[model samples]
Target: MGQKVNPIGFRLGVNRDWRSRWYASPQEMPGFLHSDIEIRDYVKKKLLFAAVSKIVIERAWNSIRVTIFTARPGIVIGRKGAEIEKMTEEISKMAQGKQIKIDIQEIKTPELDAQLVAENVALQIERRIAYRRAMKK
Candidate 1:
Protein backbone atom coordinates (compact mmCIF):
# COMPACT_ATOMS: atom_id res chain seq x y z
CA MET A 1 0.00 0.00 0.00
CA GLY A 2 1.10 3.57 -0.62
CA GLN A 3 1.73 6.00 2.28
CA LYS A 4 -1.45 7.28 3.93
CA VAL A 5 -2.42 10.95 3.54
CA ASN A 6 -2.59 13.23 6.59
CA PRO A 7 -5.02 16.12 6.15
CA ILE A 8 -3.98 18.06 9.29
CA GLY A 9 -0.28 17.77 8.47
CA PHE A 10 -0.92 19.13 4.96
CA ARG A 11 -3.03 22.05 6.25
CA LEU A 12 -0.61 22.92 9.03
CA GLY A 13 3.13 23.01 8.42
CA VAL A 14 3.86 19.95 10.54
CA ASN A 15 4.08 16.18 10.35
CA ARG A 16 1.66 13.86 12.10
CA ASP A 17 1.81 14.09 15.91
CA TRP A 18 4.51 16.75 15.63
CA ARG A 19 3.41 18.54 18.81
CA SER A 20 3.22 15.35 20.84
CA ARG A 21 6.66 14.25 19.59
CA TRP A 22 8.19 17.62 20.38
CA TYR A 23 6.81 17.60 23.93
CA ALA A 24 7.95 14.00 24.43
CA SER A 25 11.54 14.68 23.28
CA PRO A 26 14.31 16.80 24.84
CA GLN A 27 17.70 17.67 23.35
CA GLU A 28 20.85 16.82 25.29
CA MET A 29 22.51 20.12 24.37
CA PRO A 30 21.69 23.33 22.50
CA GLY A 31 23.92 25.72 20.60
CA PHE A 32 24.66 29.23 21.88
CA LEU A 33 22.21 31.88 20.76
CA HIS A 34 22.38 35.67 20.49
CA SER A 35 19.66 38.33 20.34
CA ASP A 36 19.42 41.22 17.84
CA ILE A 37 19.57 43.97 20.51
CA GLU A 38 22.97 42.83 21.81
CA ILE A 39 24.34 42.57 18.30
CA ARG A 40 23.06 46.07 17.41
CA ASP A 41 24.67 47.57 20.49
CA TYR A 42 27.95 45.83 19.77
CA VAL A 43 27.97 47.07 16.20
CA LYS A 44 27.19 50.64 17.29
CA LYS A 45 30.08 50.63 19.74
CA LYS A 46 32.58 49.23 17.27
CA LEU A 47 31.51 51.31 14.28
CA LEU A 48 31.38 54.76 15.94
CA PHE A 49 34.06 57.17 14.68
CA ALA A 50 34.36 60.00 17.23
CA ALA A 51 36.88 62.07 15.27
CA VAL A 52 34.48 62.52 12.35
CA SER A 53 31.34 62.64 14.46
CA LYS A 54 29.20 65.83 14.36
CA ILE A 55 28.06 64.72 17.78
CA VAL A 56 29.83 63.07 20.68
CA ILE A 57 28.48 61.46 23.81
CA GLU A 58 30.28 62.44 27.00
CA ARG A 59 29.33 59.18 28.65
CA ALA A 60 28.28 56.66 26.04
CA TRP A 61 26.89 54.26 28.65
CA ASN A 62 24.54 56.96 29.92
CA SER A 63 23.12 58.27 26.63
CA ILE A 64 21.24 56.95 23.65
CA ARG A 65 23.14 57.29 20.36
CA VAL A 66 21.35 58.54 17.27
CA THR A 67 23.86 57.87 14.57
CA ILE A 68 22.95 59.35 11.23
CA PHE A 69 24.28 56.54 9.11
CA THR A 70 25.81 58.28 6.11
CA ALA A 71 28.55 58.01 3.54
CA ARG A 72 29.70 61.47 4.56
CA PRO A 73 29.96 61.20 8.33
CA GLY A 74 32.49 64.00 7.96
CA ILE A 75 29.75 66.50 7.10
CA VAL A 76 27.63 65.43 10.01
CA ILE A 77 30.62 65.14 12.33
CA GLY A 78 31.65 68.66 11.17
CA ARG A 79 35.04 70.26 11.80
CA LYS A 80 36.60 69.20 15.13
CA GLY A 81 33.51 67.13 15.88
CA ALA A 82 31.80 70.28 17.22
CA GLU A 83 28.41 69.36 15.77
CA ILE A 84 28.48 65.97 17.44
CA GLU A 85 29.62 67.48 20.74
CA LYS A 86 26.65 69.85 20.77
CA MET A 87 24.26 67.06 19.84
CA THR A 88 25.62 64.92 22.66
CA GLU A 89 24.85 67.59 25.25
CA GLU A 90 21.37 68.09 23.82
CA ILE A 91 20.69 64.34 23.89
CA SER A 92 22.39 63.65 27.22
CA LYS A 93 19.43 64.88 29.22
CA MET A 94 17.05 62.81 27.11
CA ALA A 95 18.73 59.57 28.10
CA GLN A 96 16.78 58.45 31.15
CA GLY A 97 17.38 55.15 32.97
CA LYS A 98 19.24 52.39 31.00
CA GLN A 99 22.72 53.14 29.79
CA ILE A 100 22.01 54.89 26.52
CA LYS A 101 24.40 54.79 23.57
CA ILE A 102 24.08 56.34 20.12
CA ASP A 103 26.42 56.00 17.20
CA ILE A 104 26.55 56.83 13.50
CA GLN A 105 27.93 54.00 11.47
CA GLU A 106 29.00 55.19 8.04
CA ILE A 107 27.81 53.22 5.06
CA LYS A 108 30.24 52.51 2.20
CA THR A 109 27.79 54.07 -0.26
CA PRO A 110 27.04 57.82 -0.11
CA GLU A 111 23.96 57.66 -2.28
CA LEU A 112 22.09 55.69 0.38
CA ASP A 113 22.55 58.38 3.02
CA ALA A 114 21.58 61.11 0.60
CA GLN A 115 18.34 59.33 -0.20
CA LEU A 116 17.57 58.68 3.44
CA VAL A 117 18.26 62.27 4.48
CA ALA A 118 16.32 63.70 1.59
CA GLU A 119 13.31 61.54 2.31
CA ASN A 120 13.39 62.37 6.02
CA VAL A 121 13.81 66.11 5.45
CA ALA A 122 11.04 66.10 2.90
CA LEU A 123 8.76 64.30 5.33
CA GLN A 124 9.56 66.76 8.09
CA ILE A 125 8.90 69.73 5.84
CA GLU A 126 5.60 68.25 4.72
CA ARG A 127 4.54 67.66 8.31
CA ARG A 128 5.49 71.18 9.32
CA ILE A 129 3.51 72.66 6.43
CA ALA A 130 0.52 70.52 7.27
CA TYR A 131 0.66 71.63 10.89
CA ARG A 132 0.88 75.31 9.92
CA ARG A 133 -2.04 75.01 7.49
CA ALA A 134 -4.15 73.32 10.13
CA MET A 135 -3.31 76.02 12.66
CA LYS A 136 -4.25 78.76 10.18
CA LYS A 137 -7.69 77.21 9.55
Candidate 2:
Protein backbone atom coordinates (compact mmCIF):
# COMPACT_ATOMS: atom_id res chain seq x y z
CA MET A 1 0.00 0.00 0.00
CA GLY A 2 3.02 2.27 0.44
CA GLN A 3 6.08 2.85 -1.71
CA LYS A 4 9.09 2.47 0.56
CA VAL A 5 12.47 3.70 -0.53
CA ASN A 6 15.76 3.41 1.28
CA PRO A 7 16.84 6.81 2.51
CA ILE A 8 20.47 6.21 1.55
CA GLY A 9 19.72 4.94 -1.95
CA PHE A 10 17.26 7.80 -2.52
CA ARG A 11 19.96 10.34 -1.62
CA LEU A 12 22.79 8.86 -3.68
CA GLY A 13 24.46 11.33 -6.10
CA VAL A 14 22.55 14.19 -4.49
CA ASN A 15 23.51 14.34 -0.83
CA ARG A 16 25.35 10.99 -0.90
CA ASP A 17 27.58 9.00 -3.23
CA TRP A 18 28.49 5.47 -4.18
CA ARG A 19 30.86 3.44 -2.05
CA SER A 20 32.81 2.38 -5.11
CA ARG A 21 33.57 5.29 -7.42
CA TRP A 22 34.96 3.53 -10.42
CA TYR A 23 33.91 2.91 -13.97
CA ALA A 24 34.71 -0.65 -14.84
CA SER A 25 34.91 -1.95 -18.35
CA PRO A 26 32.20 -4.43 -19.32
CA GLN A 27 34.66 -7.31 -19.10
CA GLU A 28 36.14 -6.08 -15.81
CA MET A 29 32.92 -5.34 -13.96
CA PRO A 30 32.67 -8.69 -12.19
CA GLY A 31 36.22 -8.60 -10.86
CA PHE A 32 35.82 -5.01 -9.72
CA LEU A 33 32.58 -5.80 -7.94
CA HIS A 34 34.12 -8.81 -6.24
CA SER A 35 37.10 -6.76 -5.12
CA ASP A 36 34.79 -4.17 -3.65
CA ILE A 37 32.95 -6.83 -1.70
CA GLU A 38 36.19 -8.30 -0.40
CA ILE A 39 37.43 -4.93 0.72
CA ARG A 40 34.18 -4.10 2.49
CA ASP A 41 34.03 -7.50 4.19
CA TYR A 42 37.64 -7.17 5.36
CA VAL A 43 36.98 -3.81 6.96
CA LYS A 44 33.77 -4.96 8.64
CA LYS A 45 35.41 -8.07 10.07
CA LYS A 46 38.63 -6.38 11.14
CA LEU A 47 37.06 -3.28 12.65
CA LEU A 48 33.99 -4.72 14.25
CA PHE A 49 34.33 -2.36 17.20
CA ALA A 50 34.69 0.72 15.03
CA ALA A 51 30.94 1.29 14.53
CA VAL A 52 31.63 1.81 10.85
CA SER A 53 28.86 3.60 8.99
CA LYS A 54 30.14 3.29 5.43
CA ILE A 55 33.16 2.32 3.35
CA VAL A 56 33.85 4.33 0.22
CA ILE A 57 36.26 2.89 -2.32
CA GLU A 58 37.69 4.87 -5.21
CA ARG A 59 39.83 3.49 -7.99
CA ALA A 60 42.78 5.32 -9.49
CA TRP A 61 45.26 4.24 -12.15
CA ASN A 62 47.65 2.57 -9.72
CA SER A 63 45.97 2.90 -6.39
CA ILE A 64 42.72 2.36 -4.51
CA ARG A 65 41.42 4.83 -1.94
CA VAL A 66 39.33 3.52 0.93
CA THR A 67 37.49 5.98 3.09
CA ILE A 68 35.80 4.60 6.17
CA PHE A 69 33.06 6.54 7.93
CA THR A 70 32.52 5.50 11.52
CA ALA A 71 30.91 6.67 14.70
CA ARG A 72 33.99 5.64 16.72
CA PRO A 73 37.03 7.04 14.99
CA GLY A 74 39.26 6.66 18.00
CA ILE A 75 38.74 2.94 18.10
CA VAL A 76 39.40 2.61 14.39
CA ILE A 77 42.47 4.81 14.53
CA GLY A 78 43.82 3.07 17.64
CA ARG A 79 46.86 4.31 19.57
CA LYS A 80 49.06 6.34 17.23
CA GLY A 81 47.14 4.92 14.27
CA ALA A 82 48.74 1.53 14.62
CA GLU A 83 45.42 -0.15 14.02
CA ILE A 84 44.97 1.68 10.76
CA GLU A 85 48.48 0.77 9.69
CA LYS A 86 47.77 -2.88 10.35
CA MET A 87 44.51 -2.64 8.45
CA THR A 88 46.29 -1.04 5.52
CA GLU A 89 48.81 -3.83 5.45
CA GLU A 90 46.05 -6.41 5.47
CA ILE A 91 44.12 -4.58 2.75
CA SER A 92 47.23 -4.23 0.63
CA LYS A 93 47.58 -7.97 0.62
CA MET A 94 43.94 -8.23 -0.41
CA ALA A 95 44.50 -5.69 -3.17
CA GLN A 96 47.03 -7.95 -4.91
CA GLY A 97 49.90 -5.44 -4.89
CA LYS A 98 47.98 -2.29 -5.80
CA GLN A 99 48.78 0.73 -3.63
CA ILE A 100 46.05 1.30 -1.06
CA LYS A 101 45.22 4.46 0.83
CA ILE A 102 42.94 4.38 3.84
CA ASP A 103 41.09 7.34 5.28
CA ILE A 104 38.90 7.42 8.37
CA GLN A 105 36.01 9.87 8.60
CA GLU A 106 34.07 10.45 11.77
CA ILE A 107 30.28 10.56 11.85
CA LYS A 108 29.21 13.53 13.98
CA THR A 109 25.54 12.62 14.13
CA PRO A 110 25.06 8.86 14.32
CA GLU A 111 21.44 9.32 15.25
CA LEU A 112 20.70 10.75 11.83
CA ASP A 113 22.38 7.92 9.96
CA ALA A 114 20.03 5.04 9.15
CA GLN A 115 22.70 2.34 9.38
CA LEU A 116 24.06 3.68 12.66
CA VAL A 117 20.61 4.07 14.13
CA ALA A 118 19.71 0.49 13.23
CA GLU A 119 22.95 -0.79 14.68
CA ASN A 120 22.36 1.13 17.87
CA VAL A 121 18.85 -0.20 18.15
CA ALA A 122 20.02 -3.77 17.61
CA LEU A 123 22.75 -3.33 20.20
CA GLN A 124 20.27 -1.95 22.71
CA ILE A 125 17.89 -4.82 22.07
CA GLU A 126 20.69 -7.32 22.59
CA ARG A 127 21.34 -5.69 25.94
CA ARG A 128 17.68 -6.20 26.97
CA ILE A 129 16.67 -2.55 26.59
CA ALA A 130 13.17 -1.65 25.52
CA TYR A 131 12.90 -0.78 21.79
CA ARG A 132 10.73 2.28 22.40
CA ARG A 133 13.03 3.60 25.13
CA ALA A 134 16.14 2.93 23.04
CA MET A 135 14.77 4.71 19.98
CA LYS A 136 13.39 7.62 21.99
CA LYS A 137 16.87 8.91 22.60
Candidate 3:
Protein backbone atom coordinates (compact mmCIF):
# COMPACT_ATOMS: atom_id res chain seq x y z
CA MET A 1 0.00 0.00 0.00
CA GLY A 2 1.17 3.51 -0.80
CA GLN A 3 1.85 5.78 2.15
CA LYS A 4 -0.23 8.92 2.29
CA VAL A 5 -0.17 11.95 4.55
CA ASN A 6 -2.13 15.18 4.59
CA PRO A 7 -0.02 18.01 3.19
CA ILE A 8 -1.13 20.32 5.95
CA GLY A 9 -0.21 17.77 8.62
CA PHE A 10 3.22 17.36 7.09
CA ARG A 11 3.91 21.09 7.23
CA LEU A 12 2.33 21.80 10.61
CA GLY A 13 4.65 23.75 12.92
CA VAL A 14 7.01 24.37 10.00
CA ASN A 15 5.04 26.92 7.97
CA ARG A 16 1.43 26.10 8.99
CA ASP A 17 -0.75 25.99 12.06
CA TRP A 18 -3.90 24.15 12.97
CA ARG A 19 -7.17 25.85 12.06
CA SER A 20 -8.66 25.18 15.51
CA ARG A 21 -6.58 26.13 18.54
CA TRP A 22 -7.50 24.99 22.00
CA TYR A 23 -6.51 22.65 24.82
CA ALA A 24 -8.89 20.19 26.37
CA SER A 25 -8.84 17.30 28.81
CA PRO A 26 -9.70 13.77 27.73
CA GLN A 27 -13.21 14.12 29.17
CA GLU A 28 -13.90 17.31 27.18
CA MET A 29 -12.18 16.37 23.95
CA PRO A 30 -15.10 14.77 22.13
CA GLY A 31 -17.55 17.62 22.64
CA PHE A 32 -15.00 20.24 21.85
CA LEU A 33 -13.94 18.52 18.65
CA HIS A 34 -17.56 18.15 17.50
CA SER A 35 -18.30 21.80 18.23
CA ASP A 36 -15.27 22.90 16.22
CA ILE A 37 -16.41 20.87 13.23
CA GLU A 38 -19.93 22.29 13.44
CA ILE A 39 -18.65 25.84 13.77
CA ARG A 40 -16.37 25.51 10.75
CA ASP A 41 -19.17 23.99 8.64
CA TYR A 42 -21.60 26.73 9.62
CA VAL A 43 -19.15 29.50 8.80
CA LYS A 44 -18.32 28.05 5.39
CA LYS A 45 -21.98 27.57 4.44
CA LYS A 46 -22.99 31.00 5.75
CA LEU A 47 -20.34 32.79 3.71
CA LEU A 48 -20.73 30.68 0.59
CA PHE A 49 -20.61 33.67 -1.76
CA ALA A 50 -17.91 35.58 0.09
CA ALA A 51 -14.99 33.56 -1.32
CA VAL A 52 -13.85 32.35 2.11
CA SER A 53 -10.50 30.55 1.87
CA LYS A 54 -9.90 29.58 5.47
CA ILE A 55 -11.32 29.96 9.01
CA VAL A 56 -9.18 29.96 12.15
CA ILE A 57 -11.03 29.36 15.40
CA GLU A 58 -9.35 30.16 18.69
CA ARG A 59 -10.68 29.67 22.17
CA ALA A 60 -9.45 31.77 25.06
CA TRP A 61 -11.01 31.12 28.47
CA ASN A 62 -14.69 31.91 27.81
CA SER A 63 -14.58 33.46 24.38
CA ILE A 64 -14.31 32.18 20.82
CA ARG A 65 -12.46 34.13 18.18
CA VAL A 66 -13.21 33.29 14.58
CA THR A 67 -10.82 34.63 11.99
CA ILE A 68 -12.09 34.47 8.42
CA PHE A 69 -9.62 34.75 5.55
CA THR A 70 -11.40 35.70 2.37
CA ALA A 71 -10.86 37.22 -1.04
CA ARG A 72 -13.86 39.56 -0.60
CA PRO A 73 -13.80 41.30 2.78
CA GLY A 74 -16.51 43.83 1.97
CA ILE A 75 -19.16 41.18 1.57
CA VAL A 76 -18.19 39.61 4.86
CA ILE A 77 -18.34 42.96 6.59
CA GLY A 78 -21.70 44.05 5.09
CA ARG A 79 -23.15 47.55 5.23
CA LYS A 80 -22.44 49.29 8.56
CA GLY A 81 -21.08 45.99 9.95
CA ALA A 82 -24.54 44.54 10.38
CA GLU A 83 -23.54 41.27 8.74
CA ILE A 84 -20.79 40.67 11.27
CA GLU A 85 -23.09 41.29 14.20
CA LYS A 86 -25.67 38.89 12.81
CA MET A 87 -23.04 36.21 12.26
CA THR A 88 -21.66 36.65 15.77
CA GLU A 89 -25.10 36.16 17.24
CA GLU A 90 -25.68 32.98 15.25
CA ILE A 91 -22.26 31.53 16.16
CA SER A 92 -22.73 32.46 19.82
CA LYS A 93 -25.82 30.28 19.89
CA MET A 94 -23.73 27.45 18.50
CA ALA A 95 -21.08 28.07 21.13
CA GLN A 96 -23.61 27.69 23.92
CA GLY A 97 -23.79 31.38 24.85
CA LYS A 98 -20.04 31.98 24.79
CA GLN A 99 -18.81 35.30 23.40
CA ILE A 100 -18.13 35.23 19.65
CA LYS A 101 -15.69 37.60 18.03
CA ILE A 102 -15.21 37.61 14.27
CA ASP A 103 -12.22 39.06 12.48
CA ILE A 104 -11.82 39.27 8.70
CA GLN A 105 -8.49 39.09 6.92
CA GLU A 106 -8.31 39.85 3.22
CA ILE A 107 -6.25 37.64 0.94
CA LYS A 108 -3.84 39.98 -0.85
CA THR A 109 -3.18 37.53 -3.67
CA PRO A 110 -6.34 35.42 -3.95
CA GLU A 111 -5.54 34.50 -7.56
CA LEU A 112 -2.41 32.77 -6.33
CA ASP A 113 -4.26 30.65 -3.75
CA ALA A 114 -4.84 27.06 -4.83
CA GLN A 115 -8.09 26.56 -2.90
CA LEU A 116 -9.68 29.78 -4.13
CA VAL A 117 -8.59 29.09 -7.70
CA ALA A 118 -10.15 25.64 -7.60
CA GLU A 119 -13.35 26.98 -6.09
CA ASN A 120 -13.57 29.64 -8.83
CA VAL A 121 -13.29 27.02 -11.53
CA ALA A 122 -15.87 24.78 -9.83
CA LEU A 123 -18.33 27.68 -9.53
CA GLN A 124 -17.96 28.54 -13.20
CA ILE A 125 -18.59 24.95 -14.17
CA GLU A 126 -21.62 24.81 -11.91
CA ARG A 127 -23.01 27.83 -13.77
CA ARG A 128 -23.10 25.68 -16.92
CA ILE A 129 -19.89 27.04 -18.38
CA ALA A 130 -17.68 24.58 -20.20
CA TYR A 131 -14.81 23.04 -18.20
CA ARG A 132 -12.26 24.41 -20.70
CA ARG A 133 -13.79 27.89 -20.39
CA ALA A 134 -13.68 27.67 -16.61
CA MET A 135 -10.00 26.72 -16.62
CA LYS A 136 -9.11 29.60 -18.93
CA LYS A 137 -10.27 32.10 -16.34
What are the lDDT figures for the candidates, one per model?
Answer: 0.43, 0.91, 0.93
Q: Model 3 segments beyond 4 Å from truth?
A: none
TM-score per candidate: 0.34, 0.88, 0.93
How many clashes show up in model 1?
A: 11
Of candidate 2, the 10-residue stretch with the lowest lDDT total is 16-25
User: Per-prediction count of colliding residue pairs?
Assistant: 11, 0, 0
lDDT of 1 by residue, 1-137 (tens): 88988676776655332211111113411210112233334434543432222222222322344444555577556789776666555444333343444466676754344444454455556677564544333
Query: Residue 106 in model 1: shift from native, Å?
Result: 1.4
Top lDDT: which candidate number?
3
- lDDT score of residue 2 within candidate 1: 86
Candidate 1 C-alpha error for residue 13, in Å? 20
lDDT of 1 at 9: 74
Better of 2 and 3 by lDDT: 3
Better of 2 and 3 by TM-score: 3
The runs of at least 3 residues in candidate 2 whose Cα sits more than 4 Å from the true structure, single-residue gaps closed, are 1-11
Q: What is the alpha-carbon lDDT for the whole of candidate 2?
A: 0.91
Q: Write the per-residue lDDT of candidate 2 for residues 34-135, one digit (tens) a residue.
A: 999999999999987778999999998879999999999999999998999999899898889899999989999888898888888899999999989998
